[model samples]
Target: MTGFDPAAHLSEKLLERIRARAAAHDRENTFPAQDLADLKDAGYLAILVPTDLGGAGLGLAEASVLQQRLAGAAPATALAINMHLVWTGVAKVLADRGIADLRFVQEGAAAGEVFAFGISEAGNDLVLFGSDTDAAAQPDGAYAFTGTKIFTSLAPVWTWIGLHGLDTTSPDASKLVYAFVPRSEEDDGRVVTRDDWDTLGMRGTQSRTTELHAAIAPADRVVRRIDPGPSPDPIVFGIFSVFEVLLASVYTGIARRALDLAVQTAAQRRSKKTGKAYSQDPDIRWRIAGMALAYDPLPAELASISRDVDGRADHGTRWFSLLSGVKHRAVTMAKRVVDDAILVAGGSSYFSSSELGRLYRDVLAGQFHPSDPESAHATVASAWLGPIEP
Candidate 1:
């Protein structure tokens, strides 16, 4: 990890290439194949793997910064790639606590294998606690998964997908199985990739629906089977921490881009009646300042929380409250900033082809991710007020 800088790795030239393809990918609703390949070739995928395993050995702090930079250039690419990083980041979290269970994920990522997150399902809001997918245990201890996963990002290229399901057939009927299913065509075509990713924005992510037909996770690969619902398990903590931090980083990046574009637009566009640039208008300047004000605290909070996760700084039960709060704040701030930016950019930005317009749509998605506004509010309320009587 010596002398390793994540920013230097994602060079300006690389970002330019990614940025150039973003519009085309969005317009065509295609996955960013070239973007993923370039990031992999640049060793960006192994940022969280330990140095002993041929990776940068970076931590969540570095990953958060890198995510912000990547999202600024191409939000969809950053987001799609985030699922893979979350696994590796979680591996790092576990390793720091002397738990070597997920080391394989780190190794595989270092080896250029893409890992997508498949925890999301249609109308299932239990998140990490419970799953609608079925995981039937075999004699060999492996689990065969059968269910549909919605918003499976990096669908076209993932080598492994980390998912969870209910294992009713196991000794413990309440066991919630957590495991990785390999992407293969064997076993009479085990996994089905649905071509239904058309969306308002972040179109290049290709986050399609997946139908699993008894896809098996080998015994050795079956990571954890915790009791359904929340517990103090490392798997739960790891996923929540990594997912929230990285997701927040991506949205913060979007806000940064929108704010920058607003400044640029204001500097160029003029007030026809006043015979002056919009940048000179007091009202426009105030709007830009408001955007900046909303955007300021998020990156700092993202950095601090990520470093806390890396350092294993103890927040006890308050961690859930903290993580959810940061995610909610970042998303809300980003959305507000983007809205203000659109006002600054005026009518031209309203066009479909405008970057701000795309960002407007992408920022809306932040509301739909886990730790959503409603969930975040509930988590925070529970943290302070305690849970209501059953």
Candidate 2:
């Protein structure tokens, strides 16, 4: 693993192709189907699966680096693929911990099957700990889900959706059920995807709303059923750790791209007063330096935490805070960098066609993801100050 480079898997030529299509996909508000095809061909979907399972057998640290590279080219494409990677990463986590419940996920990813994360629900702030959807248990032990999931990334082409719901009627009344349901025509009217993904940015994700009408997850697909509220279940840890690290990696990549753009713009643009490039201006130099100062530590932090996850290093109860804190810092830093990059580029970046303009919009979506600003603060506060008295 010493000399492993993400570039070997995600080549520069492939990234350029993905980068070239990004603007068109953003402008048209369409899914990056070709990007998905290329990534699948590159074996990126199975990067976390074991080598014996027909995958690259890379660890989480390597996957984080690769995701950062992907995001630098196309944020929306990288974000959409993040969902698929999440499932595979979680599978790796479980397998590493001697739990094989999600082995199917790894196998499916190795076979080029796309898995969409379906945990998000409108107005449900409980996240992984709770769910608004109904998990009606059938006599055969299969559970039928009935609810709507928002921001279902890769919605147009997801082969299986990994989701959770509350099982209120089962003997274990308040258990939270985690399961995976296949996306197939034979589902009857169980699963419906709304083509309503037009957004401010990250439009290429096509993260549409999904309505589930008794979408059935067979018994084998029901991976976990844990009590409501915080639990030490491996599934919870697996999802949270993988999701946050990959998310941070994406935003960090965005910041890296923004900083690079700023440097390029500063070097190319001439200053009216000095008749020299803006890169020579004191103010411009300071601004780019500030952006660099902010961007410098993110990759190191991502690598450290991702390696901890891969190596199964124990962090006790500090895991949540660490994960949320990195995501919070990465997104905020990316927004800052993109904002400064636009300032460095001047009015040229204000136009819709500008890459900075797209980056500006794409970066804004970071705040909307889980472990958002408020949640991150709370998690950190709880970890440091201990939970408030009931």
Kindly list the per-residue Cα lDDT of model 2 for residues 226-326, writing each as its tens digit. Answer: 99899999999999999999999999999999999999999999977889999999999999999999999999999999999999999999999999999
**Cα lDDT of model 1 overall?**
0.92
Question: Tens-digit lDDT track for model 1 on 178-225?
Answer: 899888733368899988998988898899999998999889889998
TM-score of each: 0.98, 0.99
lDDT of 2: 0.95
Checking candidate 2 for backbone clashes, the offending pairs are: none
- Candidate 1 lowest-lDDT run of ten: 1-10
Go through the candidates in order and give the C-alpha RMSD of each one to the true structure: 1.4, 0.9
Question: Which RMSD does model 2 reach against the true structure?
Answer: 0.9
Residue 286 in model 2: lDDT? 97
**Best candidate per TM-score, number?**
2
- Give the residue spans of candidate 2 off by over 4 A: 185-187
